[model samples]
Target: MRGWRNALMLSLLPVLVSGGLSAAGGPDYPITPVPFTKVRASDGFWAPRLETNRKVTLPANFQKCAETGRISNFAKAAGKMEGKHEGIFFNDSDVFKVAEGAAYTLALSPDPELDAYLDNLIALFAGAQEEDGYLYTARTIDPSRPAPGAGKERWADIKNAHELYNMGHMIEAAVAHHQATGKRQFLDVAVKCADLIDRVFGPGKKYAATGHPELELALAKLYRCTGEKRYLDLAKFFVDQRGNAEHRELYGLYYQDHEPFLQQREAVGHAVRAGYFYSGAADVAALTGNPAYIDAIDRIWENAVTRRMYLTGGIGSKREGEAFGADYELPNATAYCETCAAIANAFWNHRMFLLHGDAKYMDVFERTVYNGYLAGVSLEGDTFFYPNPLSSDGIFPFNHGEPKRSPWFGCSCCPTNVVRFFPSLPGCAYATEKDRIYVGLYFGGTAEVALDGGAVIIAQETRYPWDGAVRLTVTPEHAGEFELRLRIPGWAQGSPVPGDLYTYADPSPAVITL
Candidate 1:
């Protein structure tokens, strides 16, 4: 009842809280991102891709799920089908990620067939859930004969086990589905599962954190979706528990739990995991105005940008553990920059910009969007790359022993993550403060922005990243005196990146016309 969005939801709440919540008022950053739903992209660059993801990629991913047995896992768990659990413990996450992408597609364009498909899928998910609201197909398919990484009990294996990780994707997909369709079926399941998690672990309860950092951000989303303070509290609790040995034994640096979050000044461990944790911390920092969360992510962001990041805006240098290498140790062909890590990096930088209203964050974000994660998906949208490297020999194993992109992989996180990420673009194009509208991203589009005034229509025309010429036409609802903050990219300023790690060779004066 509480989660369904109205026509003015974009005006009411802000955008891309998918990565971080942009809560208004208080000591929180005054700028709020405009939700993609309010901004439509007319630019041919992203339009074709969004349409391709919806038409080609969505059903293709769904077919792959069916063939791979991910779809049937739910049916098997629910007793609707008879079989043992199939695939890896984390396979459920891929399914959820695709579903979240599908929800985003539905928001932009109404698709009855896709809508019905999601509804039926949600039904299977509902059936797969346990009586008390526990949901995990690998275990629920047969509790007595659990799968390899399903854990001894529900919350037993926090390290390699992906129970919380899977549920985190589920919660995120559920929020997207609810926002798109205004149906509570999927959201109800997420709430039930979250409730079970809430009961199992917390302040006086288990005091655990995921070996992977996703549910923390997902919990922030759940809080925003349902307006339940408990979900936000749980998100903060999970972050608070990290590095607190008295609460739980730390998983060490590979999991970014080696030290107290506030004490951590460097970005360490698995790249994707670190990005999500910092993004969640930004969400908490924005919503709660907790300076601790702010300081931790701020420090971590600097350490990453100035040292560990790649020219492509990628991270994670070593294939071993698929983790980050030492600072400034970014290799060439052997680099293991996972596509998911790039997505996480972009997500983190977007949050940082929203938190600080700085163009540097968006600059790094643009580099990732253009060069980093965009390389993960081929033009066809069917093939994908798990590890996006800087250089590759024709015969070398760049992405897990494959030189070129593969149609699919044994671990399909990157493909599914790509599906979920592409549709989040419209929200990134614009943002708002009290009396100002920040054009954070450039694309030819029309955005119906909600100010303290009624609605303002801004039309942007440009062949961006390809052409520098931009034309903006602003029509405010009333003749209000609001400022427009146009972002001047670091690249235009002659710095390829914000930090000293990279720069441009051919420098020229940037031209801007009013």
Candidate 2:
């Protein structure tokens, strides 16, 4: 077995060393950088066009708002006059604010109803933000709160408090807002909130890493967008803090902080939390070039892919703690495949694949994208299932007793989360190396990459996922021969594979010698 493993790795080494795969019958194409183009939903993928599926766009707001009957759920949850649960729900407020703002921006021409509704929602979000840059409706953020157990002890409920989660959402909203337009109104607010959190947590901060997970990934993205070294350093700090032995007990044993994330040797804790933490850690590995962190990621990934992961690429143990159990302990009906967890897993897998150029990561991504992801929202993209239980029978129960969908959920993270992730699908398909561009996924639409000494865009016009065949038309900006690497999906491992201009059966995961 050891020799076989070594031989297998040795055989696959050339493919890794080479750019990846190749285009058609030709010389090994040199990869030239091209301006990455946006994608739109076409063929079998959710989207195939870029810019069209943005979060702040009009269509998404309409879909989410209409699905939920209105964005009034936040106000109700927030309590009109500071009733309770104010700051704890920072995550939802951030999401709602972005949804509303994007809707307002996107509805000018075609979606009048969405336009008006989003305006009202935006106003609500703005009002909710404190002058100190704090924008939480959870009671924990309330200064006038009663002592623990006297009434709603918002501060004491830190375990359930999603302060960092909300901060992460704000960061995401800001990025989306900036992407949609050149304005930085909300982006500024998000930065303020992040700065406040930075001062309180990490190295010299008062608090520690969040048990809920979220802010780390958001912080990393924010750092990337703004080029602020502080943000990047802070994100790295949080990733390192997770699952540390001393810190784990300090936070609480409930979420499996009893051991370190790397030392634990298995995925655990809240499904969404574990996914978010892992995703953030992966980001840390990518940004810092930390081989140790990446090694931990690989170990955890092996367990997940080989044993713990669900067929849908969903990871978790059960509904009890919403945590992961022993390997292969996946119980379909009792599975707590939270929608957000699935989304987070998808996000993490994409990042890993991009960082390492590993086909196994994409294998996980494809499973989650197609199965657990789709189950989150209804076919219409409205309504959601907070818990994506594998098997739904009379005993397990669905919406009430069957697998049903709801426009809005009481806790409600899943509904909005589904909307946010699905719309951002195009950004995850392909990546670039020194001068080589790699086709990691088989989705429709074009990929514009900037690499080598010039730019090259691979325009893909084909129905994919539904069918294995993909039509890739290469257009070089500089009009020169460049190498474009294609991934021979691990699934197409059988003999006499769909060998064509775009694909070929390379059992050893061969590098394309175009």
Candidate 3:
């Protein structure tokens, strides 16, 4: 049994790392997640949604991209077809995000057809790359044409071009593809694009800032996958350069360039951008052992969850810029709780949980997943809500496009983000810290956790959210000692979150066992 478990652990490491659940040695994070492949989601709540994402959601998204010209935009850029760019400058990111979702789905349910479709898509990306290794379909389609906010030349408008943002999603999709399928066709393209970014932006380079903060976290994941020091350095540079007055006078707090990264204490600017920035900073802190980054992110998290967050675990109260307003400014009817922002909140909080192993972070994580984030997509899995308002008037019309969920949007980041995120839910259930195994989320799954002593199989059965009764059975390779900690969610303890902002009227105790 020990040898079999050891072999299983070795085989699952790549899948785990690819799913962003790798427990690779890092600074002071108390627990690291078990891989997605190692955990089987049998719970009533998540299993059906996971299946919907794979069968109904992902396939429908691919068809929508084709009909909406997102996939064709890449072909147009690669000379396989002839047409003007279809949507906004950031439309290319929607394709990459969908591809990422496909990769994660393939990890859970292997499909040859989906894998082949991804390869064809990656081929288009490879063909769309410029001679200099740059890959933005909107710009690469015609270098002489002016982008919406950028000039004709490359890297002209770092403020709104979204070049780095597109690259970030591209790198993320490629890494997931490589990890899930063991294919380097997409990964090679990402590496080339990343190398180009590295060469373009650094000390004494053309730019000293990021238009959006997604690339930082993507580059960090790339570094983790390839063990490339340059990728990590590039991520750090992007995080460090924020709020340095480089672009602050022009963008101000709207772009979160008000001050230095380490000097800022509160979550500001666009909610999605601020959340991605905080998540990336946490990644940098974990990789580099930098206390400043960790401290800054901690303060920002507190500000967000305490002063600015809604009871539904939603943020970004203002509708003007789709941004965060002053503290305690939550308005349910007009709440601009963008789905992307809610998903970003989950991303940041998940990193916080990994960094500190605190149940409070998971409390928020669970809240957003069930309420804010889940509200973005419909039960059928095709229509989407870009802005999830707490209280929607029958006639007031609060969403960006329509009053209710639509099949897609012109800016389809949220829908595609949901596609990529929901399938990875099982990976968040279990984590390991040395000899101790932490069970943060209970969703009726079996987790194969690798520990210092040997491999251990943790089997969990529960009816959660609907009910709090849970049972666990642990089988170690041999009779060895290890600690297993079960987190008690705030809702179960009368508080909605960790703080005094929100509370439940009727609280229930959580039942657990060893």
| lDDT (Cα, tens digit) per residue for candidate 1, span 320-433 | 878888889899888888999999999899988878777899888999989888899988899899998788778886766679988888889999999989887779888877
**Lowest-sum lDDT 10-residue window in model 3:** 1-10
Query: lDDT of each model, Cα atoms only?
Result: 0.85, 0.59, 0.82
TM-score of 2: 0.78
Indicate the residue-level lDDT of 79 in model 1. 94
Our model 3 lands, by Cα RMSD against the true structure, at 5.4
Identify the superior model by lDDT, candidate 1 or candidate 3. Answer: 1
1 or 2, greater by TM-score: 1
What shift in Å separates residue 224 of candidate 1 from its native position after superposition? 1.1
Off by over 4 Å in 1: 1-29, 506-509
Q: Which candidate should be chosen as best, given lDDT against the real structure? A: 1
Estimated TM-score per prediction? 0.94, 0.78, 0.93
Winner on lDDT between 2 and 3 is: 3
TM-score (C-alpha) between model 1 and the true structure: 0.94
- In candidate 3, residue 406 scores what lDDT? 86
TM-score top scorer? 1
Q: How close is candidate 3 to the true structure, as a TM-score?
A: 0.93
